[model samples]
Target: MKGRATGGLIVALLTLMLAACTVVDLDADGKPIMPKDPNAKPGYSNQTPQQIAESGWASRVQQPAEQQALSWADMETKSHTVKAGASESVFVRAGGVVTAFDNSNARERHLTMTINGKPVQVQIGPVLRSNAIRDAAGFRFDEFTNQVQYAQLTKALNRHAVKQLPAVDASWVGKPVQALLAVTMAPGKVDDVVAIQLQQGSP
Candidate 1:
């Protein structure tokens, strides 16, 4: 009888351990329980990094939603060193990664570009569209996102294609920027772009 009792205790302990692992502490309605991260706070997504306490993953970590739409329109950009007769590139910083966006997308938002002190308006494209979430490994197939097929996935994800640039600058002539970047949650709206960044190099 003592041996049987010991076995039962062990089983109970094992069950408790398993329960702990499965406990996600979701809200009453099964939504993810948002933490105290300032970024997750209500209306934080629309605020700029400087305007708010912090931005990027730090904000997302505390937010209730697993995904957030980031936008940057009418963002004032810095000068870039573009090479003669080469493709100029710009980066969009999101979730800690500085990824290139399609030129068509940039043009749609009327993103301002300055090359060698000359302002130019251009669209951008993503050099790396999709990224694998480090923690999303080996979950079910539904959770898997193969970044390799980013082109097709992004094409489906972005509803509207390049439409129109409300503003355009012709000063970018004869100048090339090594790098440029911007971010936004709203598109086609006349608003200051958020989280603008740039780099200079030959590509």
Candidate 2:
């Protein structure tokens, strides 16, 4: 009887251990990993990243950018704040002089564009780090299930945005250029607009 009781306790403990493991998903560094299956997740499509990107992302980003665009002079003066979930950003449609280029690294590519005597660093990517244009549109976070869906949308937007850039190089320095930009709020970050969409030539 005592032997049967001991075996039962061990079985119960094992069952609980298995249940705990099934409920928790940990990454390599022991942090909780967010689930990435879009189909299993409500409100997101089962489509692959490329397929998902093929429709509507451009219009969604473009509408907000065109409507909210501010001139460099006006942007410097206003207290603009665009909400995206808990975060905020802004948009600019202005002309600036190309001060310099940082395209040597390739992955961290960008250029310095001076607006009203202040240097604003604009991303001209063969690789883009942030999805500022998309994020500036204020899409809700809970609308997507996981980082996979979120990042795929970003990748698509970046691809389309990059295609709009002027054919630039070291030659572009000291020339006037105009673009629509998405950037984090603040004049300090007016110098750091990631992921730009452009209007090339004499501005």
Candidate 3:
């Protein structure tokens, strides 16, 4: 019986050796190995979770405030010096607290104005207004005060009107008109206003 048992053990050992020697395409545990899933989403084996979230949010957020708006108004006005041969250059302190230094001709009026303490300048190009108002105490007066501010402000307004106006209107393009630039300096506020009239000459 011992010889029979020894024979049985030898058979079992031989079977195991044969299994190990076999070149089947199986894993170390002798289970069939499968191919990787092609549709599986890729993962970062390198980056931690926190780094991914922060990087994503940073890209979507707005930039800092300095790059956002146009330059500060008060700081912007100080840079410009009045140009040569302005049609009128007399300093007129008029209508309570409004100050006007105007240079004008038949073609246009360029104005330098200081209202309250703010400075603005403007060129009244050949555009006609049926009836324009220039006030002593208002935002419009501020536009007349500073040349740079008034030019920028009027350019914006005129551009808006030009866009809406009909293209075929020839009179709207190059018609000479009366232009008035005024400055108002009130308590705690400075302003300039430019008034244009088409029917009359420069004002």
Question: Each prediction's Cα lDDT score?
Answer: 0.31, 0.70, 0.33
TM-score quality measure for candidate 1: 0.21
Q: Per-residue lDDT of 81-162 in model 2, one digit per residue for the tens?
A: 4233333456778788888988888766788888788788888786777767667766545656678787777776677777
In order of lDDT, best first, we have 2, 3, 1
Better of 2 and 3 by TM-score: 2
Off by over 4 Å in 1: 1-114, 117-119, 124-144, 147-203
Q: What is the per-residue lDDT of model 3 for residues 1-203, given as tens digits with 9 covering 90 to 100? A: 99999999999999999988745488889897766579855432333333322342223111211122122243234223323322111112221122342434534444333333444443343342211111211123232435544334333433332233222222322332222222232332333333321122222
What's the candidate order when arranged by decreasing TM-score? 2, 1, 3
Shift of residue 122 alpha carbon in model 1, Å: 3.3
- Taking all chains together, each candidate's TM-score versus the true structure is 0.21, 0.66, 0.18
lDDT of 2: 0.70
Clashes of each: 30, 1, 27
**lDDT for position 64 in model 3:** 17
* Window of ten residues with lowest summed lDDT in model 1: 130-139
